[model samples]
Target: MTKSVIQPLETLRLAQYAVPIPCFVCGTDNMFDAEFCTHCSAPLALAHQADNKKVHPRLIAMVGPSAAGKTVYLGMLMDMLSRRPERMQMLARGAFSITLQQTTLAALARCAFPPKTPSEPERWNWVHCQMRRAGKRQTVEMIMPDMAGEALLEEVDHPHTYHLIRCFLEKCTGAMVLIDSIKLREGAREQDFFTMKLLSYLSELTSNDKAGWRKRPIALVLTKADQCRECMNDPAGYARTHAAGLWQHCQERFGRHKFFASGVAGTCAYRESMTEGRVQVPLRIEPHGVIEPFEWLLSELERSGKKS
Candidate 1:
């Protein structure tokens, strides 16, 4: 009898079973007990698993220019979810998915922006949230990527940064592209070109099957509406008149797109105090309709799951 030799591939495959792993969302590894991804903190298993068979974990991309209130919006969204039991009851039963929750919450507590040390053009922050919706506990994994506007305008020849954008867009299920409403009002001509370029690039990427991005839902969100007092006074009217052009462009290019407005720090601009070396209160915090777009996206996801 010849001695049996274990193949390298077989050895590698066996290493996978060594650990009793936890769900990426809920941190529960037991099949009957696990309902979410433990490591990443997303729902991977659930009691009503059959109903959600077609439900795939979605990547919600939060895209915006610097200081456009993306970080604040995210912090407030998480804060809102934490306080509203009824709103989050549909999510998994837990305080937070993982340690990341503490970091996010801490950043919010400081009333300052999250860590945004400039190194790369794109940086991602993930938040795992459990909520109750449609009579079932659900897990929502949100991916927030902040890309520098300068980088967006940079030529695609910058291979590393360009590839990062491509990768994020490819995996994204839905996107919230934020535009600074105040900047628009300030006659910032550069923004128009940036927005057009970004949208056009994304459209091209999604249309190309070779690029692996197709059929992704996108929401064009206008941020800092509070600064535009006129628009804040009547959001519906502003969206109809001023925002209509952008909306139409998206419809023509992406086919599936919606327009929305959100304000995280209801103030106009930040003012630094001379003596303190700290920033003075720039504006009042008046968040409005910040959650609606996300809610709509979740509803869309649910509907898609049901149809499937």
Candidate 2:
């Protein structure tokens, strides 16, 4: 028998995947096998579903310090919107998108708040949904990620560490900055400084005057408003006094912005636990002022007809 020499494969069998897929958020081209954008760490699935040739999806971010209740507020908003018919309806795109809503509402139903979001980028939950607004011909494709507060702070302190945060801020349609109202009411100045840092960080992310935050509608959300009656009463006023730095930053830099309060817990009680030391348990599920900021942002986006 004659020995036959086989030719070596010169190219990858799946050359199409090797061509690179551009990240929708950061525009960074990544490998097809990448589950998340290599540069920004945002889910690659976003890029898969996105059709930028047509109308681009609008992205919004929920940011706050650790324990600021970003998860609770988003979860509550999703839950409330799901229950109410004829209002904004969110249809989650991927199965992963529903995880945040599912876990959040389930915890609330059990009289507990959702657990803290993990720091790992891959572990983070992202919301990709088509928001069906009443009276609108086309539904809005919305992308909102629940980012870790520590990660946000880290990015603010040291830029480029979290490319996803920077990319999102640069390309985001709007942002909802959450401030723990309970902490603010209790005379916490850290929140003020942190928010100030956040505003500055966002400002420095881009230099284009036309693309500045002046046009992006920002909503300063006072989360856990149920703990404080005054916050629920007057969120803007609360910002003016409690978060002077943030208030002034918005006034000076941002054109379209609003202050709002939201809470998922009605009344909370101190519960002693072995694993958690002491935890705050919601006595009842009362979502107050949860939808106002979202509604306001949506309306603003609708009227503006996409960011210029």
Candidate 3:
């Protein structure tokens, strides 16, 4: 006697239920049936449901020459994102994208600078941050390639620089270009050349790509503003009077841009007294509007996404 064969569908009737997932933005455990994060109200793992789901997360590159305080600025920005009360609701959490992230963070924690060193050809550091704003959680990733001053100068003649620039520009939604105010004050001729070359390359990239690449927003960041109190006192006015030429150049090329001042170290100088042996005395480091540019970029992205 042949017994009736059980159907394959009937054999799988006792499948186990999938477990609830935790929110990537706010760490809230969400049931499999949930749609949004319960703690932060941000959509939990629902990129498919978002408007402009094809739109990639904005990449905010921090471009600057060596010793221009790029690493310090990043450290301070992360510090602000983690502790600033005003930004608490907006910031979710920040983490390093690679092993280098922790290394950089550790160096910053000690108020020491990164080794100013790279042993490999393709070394880079990146930080990934999840931010919440207007009931939406967006990720902001920053990429900083480890390049020496000499290497950057050589990049002008090499095709790799252009390749790197193109790769970064294609993925970026916005940018913050850091200019070393102290270097400018010291009359560094190399800095002037680097700035012009970098900007010109960016302009060419945007212009050649006629597919609306120029629409990406950019911010010209003047670092070490603490050394120039007069400039910090009236940042807008300073940009208009002193940075007018550069600003105009960027505006003509990029279509959307702004100028800003930032100082990561709250003092101007530091001195180690022999009498006290290891006691470090803080000098004139003043932090003024260091995070303003980033805040503006975030606002702009939020507005742009909302409109879409």
Candidate 4:
């Protein structure tokens, strides 16, 4: 009779631990089979993709207060870019990366925006894709996370509260700061304070002096500008006139910054639901000024540095 021998359990475990996978966000060592980063809870799929391509992807952060229209803006932007493919094009790197675009489009087709993003880093939809300009050969690998506004505020007020947000912001080279134009137009001091706090927090986090928040490019986007045509006509003037505090802060602290206005909802209606109460629904989809800020940011980092 032939006898079979089994490998030692300790040896098997040792083999499993031999190669360590470092998180792309937090740089924490994880088992090769880990599905999420232990430190920051970022998807391990990003790490695996990075390893497979042997390329470091640039990170951009989209941050704003709760109800700032981050979800709608991001969802609409991705859907438009992926479908239009006129000026610039984006090709998602992995299958998991397209979930945000897919879900957002599906919801929009039903005249509703995507639901609020979950606060958990692992649950959040991360956009991992390559951007290519018209007639350009080399593509830029980028990862953008749609972070929760509440989680971001919590981290800003209390450091390390959201390790994923903090670590992601610390490593991001650019940021899109979304301001609710509807609130600003109505003179909400709370909006001003929230933006001020976020900018100040970023200033402290990246105070390298030589190349910190001051040098990083920021696009102050006034979302929901369709409600007020004046915002779209002249974004800079709108900022200076309405959000004076935020405008002044950017002028003094940041070196490269610009103002933009974007609106995804063509028309809206408030409807009462039995279960969810009052909710706003989009009547139609008409994207405006959505691609300008993104294109400008990419241009600044890639070729043209518009420092104003």
Candidate 5:
């Protein structure tokens, strides 16, 4: 019954699996073909791309509550940067990176906002791009993820509920904390409280004064400012007046922080939907104050890099 046949050895394949690729977010070792990190569920494509490019990308956290428009802001920011190379150009590292921009622009083209980001770690959109200024020779590699608001709140209240959020926040070099301008203008204390809690959580991540979040740049953006004239006029003053607690907390805890107002929709109207109740639709596409905060954050990062 024994039949001997010539077979080629798979030594190369065996050797490939001998070495484990470390997860970029949580540093968990996994097989090379693993799609998501076993520990945190972050896409392993980030790790592969970084390895291939031989670059260490800095993580930027987009932190906010539900309906704060993190997705819209990030999408608009990436799309703008990708199109306009005169200021700063962003080149996506992989095919997966373009998913965020594609989905965002497509939905906006239909006069609707993108669907809510699911709370699951695997469902989050992580963007890895190389950014280069028009006049500068140096390029900065960065990774940013669109995280779900409810999940962020849960992690803030109960640490480790989402391993990806905790790991990413701890390692993030900079953060943009978005608060809904419309909600604050309507006298909602929930936005103010949630942002404060998020900041407090960030500050407690590290105890070293030199390396703590106090020294890191924080962009406190009031989104949906087109509808709030006062916010668009002066974001800092608006934050001070409307969100006193959040303003005071930032003043006390964070050292390098700035407030900026950004709006994506020119106007919005509500419409009844069969699947989802009433949904807000954009009447027109207009971006205002979208780049200033990002520009400031980049400058701060560049300065920090030079200092270090």
Candidate 6:
């Protein structure tokens, strides 16, 4: 004997896939249910959330060289804003957005720095959030990616090496270019040269006079400034003296840019490890100048919006 059961047709699911969704990073069309872009490998969650929320997000680039503290700085910034919530409030959009913040804070609690972001675009941590200032009815949707420094260098050295990065930077409203204050103070010229090249790449990315990078706001942030009092006090002066080449390039190429100094670890020490050789460990967390650069960038964006 055989039993027969009734089945329902799910044609609506097929209809959803019939319409193609464009990737947020590269704008490549993919099936509606696809998790990652086929061409760029960026998470499709960003596109889905943006579409469902009916808001277009502004992109902010947190760019720097390897070990320049991009991960630590961004994680700390997010935590601070969420905890305080008096001046500015940041609410994360999806579960994926919180991964960077969670990992960074977890590592800091253990007195260790978070691992470096991988060079592959698919492994990057992207943050999408809703931000609103106190006493304001308007809210802005923003997207920030914690991209690997080595990958960024590769893209700048050879154009189109990272298509996702190129597309994202071209759409960025503002950028925070971080340089290691300790490296600059120690007379390392590599940091200075890399930053100059990155700035040049941004300026040449677009030729439209109105929408070029020269017209957008940029913040040249000096990370790990706690070790250098001069950098903490006067970032512009420190850049002029130490990173003269970068300072001159910014002056000549970028029309709207400012200098900032930020530090997270109050003190750090080197420790030997059995598994991974020697590593640096933070003694305590004392953040300074963390929010100023971000605030300045937002204000500039708002100012530009009003002018237009």
- For candidate 1, the C-alpha RMSD (Å) to the true structure equals 8.6
> Can you give the TM-score per candidate against the true fold?
0.66, 0.91, 0.65, 0.93, 0.96, 0.96
Give the whole-model CA lDDT for all candidates, comma-separated.
Answer: 0.55, 0.85, 0.57, 0.87, 0.94, 0.92
Candidate 5 structure quality by residue, lDDT tens digits, 1-308: 99999999977898889899999999999999999999999999999888887667999999999999999999999999999999998899899888999999999999999999999989999899999877988789999999999999999999989999999998999999999999998999999999999998999988787898999999999999878878988899999999999999999988999999999999899999999999999989899999989989998998999999
Alpha-carbon runs more than 4 Å astray in model 3: 1-55, 88-95, 98-111, 117-122, 134-153, 161-165, 206-213, 236-245, 268-286
| lDDT, candidate 4, 1-308, per-residue tens | 97999856676677878899999998999999989999999998999899988666889999999889888888778877788677888888898878888888899899887888877777889899888877877677889988888888889889998889889988988999999999998999777788989999998896577667888889999999878788998998998999899999999999899999999989988899998899989888889999999988887777523342
- For lDDT, the strongest prediction is 5
| Clashes in predicted model 1 | 24
Q: Write the per-residue lDDT of candidate 1 for residues 43-92, one digit (tens) a residue.
A: 44321332344544455666666656666666666666666767554232
Please give the lDDT score for candidate 1. Answer: 0.55
Clashing residue pairs in candidate 4 are none
The clash count for each model shown is 24, 0, 6, 0, 0, 0
- Residue 158 lDDT in candidate 2: 89
Cα error of candidate 6 at position 38, Å:
1.3
lDDT of 5 at 189: 93
TM-score, candidate 2, is 0.91
Error of 2 at 123 (Å): 1.1
What's the C-alpha lDDT at position 304 in model 1?
51
Which ranges of candidate 6 are over 4 A from the true structure? 1-12
RMSD of 6: 1.6
Weakest 10 consecutive residues of candidate 3 by summed lDDT: 44-53
Task: Using lDDT, rank the candidates from best to worst.
Answer: 5, 6, 4, 2, 3, 1
TM-score of 4: 0.93
Q: Say which prediction, candidate 1 or candidate 5, comes out ahead on lDDT.
A: 5
